[model samples]
Target: MSSELLPPNWPAMSIAEANAALAAPGSPVQVEDTVIDGVPSKGYTNAPPNIHSILFLAAMTHPERDYIVYKDERVTYKAMLRAVEHFAATLRDKYGITKGDRVAVIMRNYPQWPVAFYAALSLGAIATPMNSWWTGEELEYGLSFAGVKAAVVDPQIFERIHEHLGDLPDLKHVIIAREPGDEHNHPSVSSMEDAIGPANSWADLADIGMPDVEIGPDDDATIMYTSGTTGKPKGALATHRAVIANMFNSLTCTARMYLRKGEAVPEPDPNVTRATLMSIPFFHATGSFAILIPTALRGDKIVTMYKWDASEALPIIERERITSIGGVPAIAWQVLEHPDRDKYDLSSIEVVSYGGAPSAPELVSTIKRRLPNAAPGNGWGMTETCATVTLNIGEDYVNRPTSAGAPPSAVELKICDPDGKEMPAGEVGELWCKSPSNCKLYWNRPDATAETFRNGWVVTGDLARLDEEGFLFLVDRAKDMLIRGGENIYSIEVESALYDHPAVMDAAVVGIPHKVLGEEVGAVVQLKPGMSVTEDELRAHVANQLAAFKVPVEIHFMDQPLPRNANGKILKKELREQFTPRG
Candidate 1:
């Protein structure tokens, strides 16, 4: 190759190869379709499209690059792609995870999580990721709701499975990652490693060659459970086109804002290895569709964490030279406040993307101050939108820090009044989104499906406003709005102000019924470690900042942490349930 023809740091691969490095794995080339019982199944009528597209592209372009790192274990792109294929083959030939079959995965962030997830997806089986932190009751609800016939569970959660076993009568198999203490005594559970290892370490399946199984662009790819804020959690079905389209949109936005930002960003070289630290849970759409899929599609390295521990994450970021991070506000805050934070060389971090919940201004400012090399990007979406509907990118972020940015290329956004009439810019209303990434319907919940999805727009249950510049700002959950003495108060507004207090570690505001006022504001706050402040002082602090109606009439201090879901979202419903006086 002529020197002039290639840029100084250009990769060995040609531009076509570099471009292919980012392509999705098309339908599987040669794979057989297996049968699944009891599901109103859609046979593999389409070629192995999405998973095949991603795996093939990554293997061909960035074959030897690191794909995942879990503790001491590391797998390269070539090896990882093979593992996915091999496991997928095993599922088809050995197990019966066929098209449209519900295969659930219950594990924290680990190498096996993605392996099981994509393996199921490759077979045209609908992968369902349940929160690892879910109780037995919650797990039973999800298991039965998704019609989950089989599940890959971490051994740690074994007891929870046993608790719900009688209820999950349809469950045919339980694939455990670790070995059982005594095989005969362990019931129906079997070791996944033993089941798949004899076939070879999942890498051989990529090349073993099997008959082709067809899949469609619109076939179900994954089913993510809702936060269950309203009542019981419902599964939201995401098709291949929807998931892939979400990845494509995220890739485009990140390529411009995140991957291209710093001197350490390496000028988009196909050869310069990129790695990411996984902080988000595998069950959420933010983790699977947003972070993992995009990184895998790019053939970037992923370092897994069993759970987000700031002390452990900082070392990993410096050790891995992690280029990008995507997580909730809590993880970002934890990392920033880690004891040995300054010891780690976090200069390698370029983009610190955050979502899950609206970031506290203090946390946002803290990240910007501490990690000058990293910029905080916020996203807004739900399980229905496949993670990101609106993204705050580049200069728009500084101009409007509170805004969640504009809708991504793949999504359309609008704020509408209670009657579904479009609201003017800067006017608060229900935030609605329309996109291919939007779920087809709420699984088995026809009434919810109708209520949430109307005329192609998914009602997010979020109250928000779009600015003149098209930036979306979330106010709070519509259900969380407090109507006190004929005055409307958004809890988020009050909570954000409370967070500004140095003594405040966490804060949640809700409405309590009042005999005279109809309802009064009640604030629940947790103080920073070793910090102490009186309720009068806290109330005065807020009163000085916000309107009187928005100020808390009562304050409750807690020594314990706020109750949160797996994604780090405060479970206001639980708090309400706990605080409300029972007869």
Candidate 2:
């Protein structure tokens, strides 16, 4: 959509003009040409040299401010820094963890997670955050794959990986957070309380100070594993620069939002506290790079949850005055449609954003209708890109509901055909992105790295198109697109149509085997509570928006939300099994 068609006072300046002003020299988010891993790319000139620098700045700037809020516990930046320093000292002095050693952080979204992560990075050790939801065998594979020397895990994760610890001989130390009184007689296992004390008492611990280690911008800082749906998960090795680039890109996006509104960007106001409800797990890039690091740098409070529950989140928002709420679309949907949402004082919310899945356009309008103070935001990113490649929010999202917002000046986006040839705008093809935030390589998988990372661009498997204004419209994953009798069908289109139905809460479209056609369109839908819809009614609703062939031949009603992976993407493979023929 063009700016001329946008709502009045929305996008007062063109996207190009906003980007030009933001990237000009002397700007806080100035963009510059640079080389990354032998390939030319654009990078932020003012971004922190590394993640530890951001942590140091945060601690020095906001010592007594609340940094992390879990259930009944609140940790200040001073306490967090103390814990990080003490843990770093323990890792170095006790376990002999040094630069270049891989230290795995396998835990849920707790205060200890960030402590473990920052401590390892501060010591120049590669911080590998494994999925806490993974099974014992999967955890074993991740630990061995990275050759981790030490691991910090929650009590539940400890039990999950306890049986596999003997299998991973390279793992020399294990620290369990909030361990129960039961004694597990393991040689390598230890308690986190012994290292840094409890979460609240961290500030009183003897602070040995940050580890004296040299960490360069291009040095490997993280090894984040991808959500393995098709095959074994590949670990994307990211540099310190790659992860920190996200912080600047987010700042640029925020500046652009102000410039596009014909308003000057405001300076930071320390008196007004900004808080975000962290519903997503820190294991994902969207959680770690996008939310965790950025919020810390700005001294924003992060109210975390053990898991996402709208009932639990609403009261926290009311209590903490959360300024932002985000995760997957399902998270925002539950909050907006919650039966008791009106019972709370949720006037502080300003942004309700989500990504990592296809969202219904209706969700945008719903947010506008229900929460007048909040603006609905969406973006497109992947594990390979770190996060925040393109952000669509506020009026821009309302104007082009389907298109993901354009990239910042520091990133390049393109559409390519199957043969790696660039495609023209409005053409459906694989979306490729090039930026300083792109991961260096897939750990221990040279062939996979060669296939995915072409030059500096990460060949994202998502099938998308660029509009004339550079807005991205995602069609579907390249592998998820189905062919029925030689006609291509994008599953997202059908899923979007299903979501258009008022009663539908979550929906997934998958291909079911057919004797005649190569594959038939099939759908699994979960309706909102107290809502009812027949399979025929849903088919008719979709038929009104899509072709007959695209309509689902079989529709399965689910009592619960559609199954998703750790990254909040719908598990179409598991849903496909529902259509399996009974022998």
Candidate 3:
């Protein structure tokens, strides 16, 4: 599909039309009100606010507040705005990165991430964030899929780009963020410092004479690639309004919870800025939408650590007085178990949100004991949902840790069986969501996109349930996959590589909980007749073909014929139950 098909001016129903549909019979309601009142109603009462308006507000209202704080470097909202203007003007003036083009940002969590993101958003260009951990082959697939023309990459990963040079011929510029002592010497790659240079080298944005690239609320803003149960990953294309609305929904949900708990919100005193201890990778939506975007829009201070180490994170959080943090379930586990956790005065941590994967109920109790004010909340959404649809707020989190909470105001969720029939309340079924916060479509995969985004809802491929009181709880995924350390691992993709091994007859991948990694991949396999394979050999075979995350942690060889049912299909559910621990 042409990128222009999902433009900013795409047809969308009015707010009134949306509200009526969401409030229609049998929809999930907010858990807070449901517990308080006898009657049921759709959770959100407000419309999804425009993100472009919020950007303008941040530029004007909190101009002087600290917007980004990397080690020894900080940029105020005013300064960041100017930086965005100059860089965006540079793109227009130098490379012609105009509306509808995709600009790729390939880096870990850093100040440059949001700078590049908002710069692209400012010019109506879509920001397609690639996983920093992705191999050259994976990066090539993503770059080609999105038709990305340019990339702003970290110097650390720039060395890996040569492997895919031939495949990415359309790629024009490589903007590398130079480190100290590196100097401007690379012949192939352009130095970003040499390009943007100290944030004030370019002409004033007003005098640049660039046309105002106007983008509507529904314009494509981000393309987040998520692993599919099928072989390849798919890029979920989210709109500008969708990304902003999800951020607002997250903030509103957090604010409401604090109010209900009788705790006064940390004043919207624009002077009281939030400092975030960011360890989550920017490739994921939780890092970009929940942590980075919200902080940038609020003119908050961000402390970014490129590598995620538990020991390093705790000290940084305490030293920075980090007030807010968001990460996967595994990250929370590390922080709670840090050796010197009690030594630090982590009292400033008001909110610690978790997403990417479901958390065990035990983690919630652990968080409460570690940080008194901290409430462990769940963020539930797929890439197609902009990584947030249902969020477990503070109050609901304190009350019901296992619940996925209520759907965001801009979102509408429904549970359906495999046959696409709506399931009754409390019955486990595939979860589907519709929202202005939802992605417009998948990039360049029409068949997959059509199957996932049906009728108006994105079929998340996750199995879940809506309780009688309207709280959503995840059961499993309709698609077979494992989430280890919050990174998604597709079973079929891994199994396909295993099946190619000369000694392997069959294989199945399943998730098993670990004390450290929230979940670990366990591979159950059967060797071909009269053939034998060592576990280490099999592991090495798959490791070469797949990324580290997709490599199985445990390998089990079965002697008897692999378990199968009538019609000769492997009964994976029985295998999962047979091997997975119950207690």
Tens-place lDDT digits, model 3, residues 1-583 = 2333132432243223333344444432221222101223223333233444554567678876776666666666666666676678767777789888899998777667776877787788889898887778778888888998878888766767756766787787667764421453533357666545543332233433223777766677888887432367788888776686676556555554544444554556755777888766767777787666777666777787767677777778888889876566546655765567788888998777776554555566666777878756786766776767767765466556667776545456789987889988988778888665667778888898889877667788777888775678776665565677778676656765776676665577787767677777778887655678898998999989988887877788887645542112355666776565422
**TM-score of candidate 2 on Cα atoms, chains taken together:** 0.97
Model 2 alpha-carbon miss at residue 537, Å: 1.2
What's the best-to-worst order under lDDT? 2, 1, 3
Superposition error at 100 for model 1 (Å)? 1.1
- If scored against the real structure, what TM-score would every candidate get? 0.85, 0.97, 0.73
**Tens-digit per-residue lDDT, 448-491, candidate 2:** 99999989999999999999878899999989998998999999
CA lDDT, candidate 2, residue 254? 76
- Superpose all Cα atoms of candidate 3 onto the true structure and report the RMSD in Å to 1 decimal: 13.5
Best by TM-score: 2
- How accurate locally is residue 261 in candidate 2, as Cα lDDT from 0 to 100? 77
Model 2, position 134: C-alpha lDDT score: 95
| Number of clashing residue pairs, candidate 1 | 18
lDDT of 1 by residue, 207-325 (tens): 75422667767788888998776678888988886677666545444443432232122345676777789887879888888877777676788888877777788889988999887
